[model samples]
Target: MNTFIKSARVLSDGQLPKSGTIYPVLFMISISHLLNDMMQSLIPAVYPLLKEKFGFTFAQIGIITLVFQMTSSILQPFIGRLADRRPKPYSLAIGMCFTLVGLLTLSVASGFVPILVAVGLIGWGSSVFHPESSRVAQCASGGRKGLAQSIFQVGGNAGSAVGPLLAALIIIPFGQSAIGWFALVAVLAVLILVKIGNWYKRQLILATGKSAVSSEAVHGLTRRKIHTALFILAVLVFSKYFYLACMSNYFTFFLIDKFGISVQSSQYCLFAFLAASAVGTVVGGPLGDRFGRKYVIWGSILGAAPFTLMLPYTNLVCTILLAIIIGLIISSAFSAILVYATDLMPGKVGMIAGVFFGLMFGLGGIGSAFFGWLADRTSIEFIFQISTLLPLLGIITGLLPNIESKREVLNK
Candidate 1:
């Protein structure tokens, strides 16, 4: 009787309803994403403070990022594969608890080893959070996968934008102990996620014995073609994130070094770039839904190349403007890329999201560490000049098959 009632109810009065775009769930999940990423963003946002306090070198800072990101990256695929086979409804909240503890530990961490341990815990939390959350986003997409992903992604972008600003205001002045306050954010996230978990549990019960929605591959592509396209997408991820790693981890240093700006002022500038990224993320998905993912991917990645190439030569004002433009244009590619990959190999949403998100963190980590090491050897400005060339690799987007149109035609 309970099973029949759930089937008839079909998702709590049209909120997570049976056959439409469940905006409520999407928005709620997006909020969780926002909180999750906002907390994560605090790590880099506090780097300057950490460096000054600990008298740490750039190389040490890079290793911190490497440790955090590697821990975040390594477990994602395995966790995602597990979730694909067996969904863990409450695991989201469970993961956030790790972040909560990490925050507390970081607040009191006195030495290098303690800081590393704290960050490692936070990374573990992120590793568990992303894959399942991504699977849930897709499950609730109601066929508007691109729009759904954009909605989900924009939250993280917004969080990333907000975090540094908050850090500049709070942690920079009050010192490390202030990090403890963010644990409250994690607590709130835990509460919200408990509610989401309840909904997810009902969804599992509702879905038992039911066939999942269609996730057929693009109709005309061979397995080899699919693999080739995925490889291209991976390379695009590398380009986009490697550049972003530079910005997120080191752009403030670039500004501080070149412009002689105050630390707080540089953080505000970083906020501008990340805020622009959030706005661009909002546009990327729906545009892909309306147009095709391939074009969006191609244009987004390549379009930023000119601006990036010009960035190293510009005045401070021009540099900030160029950074905004670069952020807006380049950031849009991620949603389109992820959606495109999922479209290529349907039904394995968990594993694919895990791989891509993992790759994103893993590559971003490696890039951060390399740039840190290089900056130690050379200079921040020189690295920026060299990294700008990465986006030129977007030309490879041409090699990606036009799968969306083909799929549409086949469906019709």
Candidate 2:
């Protein structure tokens, strides 16, 4: 049913396909990712200002986040599913348009309802951006899927890290109207996506040749086994993102409460953790390409557990260092886990990306809300003590059957 489709051929992990890694295309995709996520990250950064200007409550603030993120989460798989069935070369560019409008809307929004609508627009844009762009990354990967993914992802992580700093510097000082300035960033993203879209269209034409083969299945897994593995992966994702939510949403609070640090100092400490995460993301994928992904997955998540367990008991210096350690180690697992899943389910790349990315967004949202409720019931320090236990779930990493070993068995 593939229209003028290239033969969709699948290979075992790390095997080179016919195409070569297109770094220019990869860099373009990565830059688009940076611009896209940077715009989205502005919402939370501006929340304090929004509260002061609008006289909004914490409850309303939560509602804003919920609306923005849920749109970002819930619509992904559907868009990905549709794109899988019907590949849209220009969808990336079209998606950026949504972000552009959202930025404009948010900049001028005078009422709470308008702000919600604006954020929802931005979220919907993100839901479209991630899956399609991920597929594009793989197409240009030259079989280096893990490396492509990490490059694409690290851009986002870097953008997320930078957005807050930019907001604090630019938007905070200039006030709400300054949100409009970010529309320029969105416009830059649109231009890059257009070029990527053209490249994707060319790939389509080139791929229509006989060298394109249909997707091959992962060698040894049964339907049941595949499902089981996916479920296990989801559980691990939950553990990683939920624990991350604790750090991302409330780590600053924990530092202030536990060490009586200034808010600015805590933010600096948080940035250190975030920067380490970006580095970990870049490192994990190339390592997965070299080592078996299962080992990387097992090590990345489980290796961080000891540090996480020690975190709550540490003083100021040790706490920051522990957080950085935990961030670097745990962050590596996601790229490995994501690449592993795609290797198992080769034909369903877009769907898998959608589901995993959606889960990350959804679980992080749930974790933030859950911890907020928990912190209310107990103390923030107590919640940190409890959140530290989530990484213990990484012990389940040992349960994942090695896909490479299974492939070897099938070949023999």
Candidate 3:
């Protein structure tokens, strides 16, 4: 026990140390992220079951997501800023406990109100979790920010893919009651986070002051240029995540209505797209490191347009194939865009991560709610037809100033 404590202190504070791409720590956090997001993914994964069980309208479903998202999205930036001032390493474990309770409560919830409460609890946990975890990944990165983010995000993407598959395999058959069993995953994550927290705590004590926002202000940018880049990044995030919201929340319905597929089968298709997204995420970061983030941003967001345009018109097999293509192509933008933004505002890592991630959730919530209303007024098919146009806004990518060359100069 003494050895364990001593080792923990050393590893956490300074022994292992942040150097060149700490794989072990990176992978540990990545796995924790997988567990964290896998649990989150369950919310959407069981939507078909939730709708049927509750006699919910599409709009109600949208509201459910909004509540969850608003609770999760709004708090991130503030918490991120606070964490920058005072590091709370153990907060990660405490956050997971919220999820554990929320999952258990969801298992037993009988009505819409209780369901909201449960999901809201989960969302609050998420709001606390992401900013800190993102910082942890960056701390562990040594210097490979893009690769670390990719590795971290791939875990989330994989978890997002797996959650639906798990829901289809486990929860769908056993009913919502089965969600209780997943609390074990939360427990497991807490254990991992406990160790990570100890390390983080030691780092805080030792930190003469290494924070997530070391490079908060870029070297050669005007305030106006910074704001312009940030706004552009936000627009790009809106385009990406909103389109994603349509699929993540409503794709099952689209498949059910159009192809007459089983809930399980539709989930399998969504899993395929999410899995492709994971692959894209893994590729994008490394590619950006080798190439340039701007090129990656342009290619990822714009290159996906053709497939997005084709999705609404395709048959079932073609639709599934188009989805995979779109996921693969478009999914690459996030890490690239995020890293680019971080480069733009190096000093505000926690704040920037929180803002972008929060926007990802917030925009997704709005999109889900909007599309849900649209679906009720028109059709799920119609919503897809309209959503396909969003990626066209990627043309604005051209307006982004070339920062990669600037970064290389700074590195020299």
Global lDDT scores for all candidate models: 0.88, 0.80, 0.85
State which candidate has the highest TM-score. 1
* Candidate 1 Cα deviation (angstroms), residue 260: 0.7
Candidate 1, residue 268: how far the Cα is off, in Å: 0.5
- What candidate 1 gets wrong by more than 4 Å, as runs, is 1-17
Candidate 3 lDDT, 180-261, residue by residue in tens: 9999999999999998888666655554333322333444889899899899999999999999999999999999998899
Question: Candidate 3: misplaced stretches above 4 Å?
Answer: 1-18, 209-218
Candidate 1 structure quality by residue, lDDT tens digits, 1-412: 3453333223211123456777888898899999999999999999999999999999999999999999989999898776766677899999999999999999999999999999999999999999888877876788788998999999889989999999999999999999999999999999988988887887778665554444456558999999999999999999998999999999999999998999999999999999999999989999999999999999999999999999989999999999999989998999999889888877667778889999999999999999999999999999999999999999999999998889889879
Clashes in candidate 1: how many? 0
lDDT of 2 at 400: 81
Which residue pairs come into collision in candidate 3? 12-199, 213-347, 215-346, 215-347, 216-346, 216-347
TM of each candidate vs. truth: 0.95, 0.91, 0.94
CA displacement after TM-score superposition, residue 305 of candidate 2 (Å): 2.0
* Best candidate (score: lDDT): 1
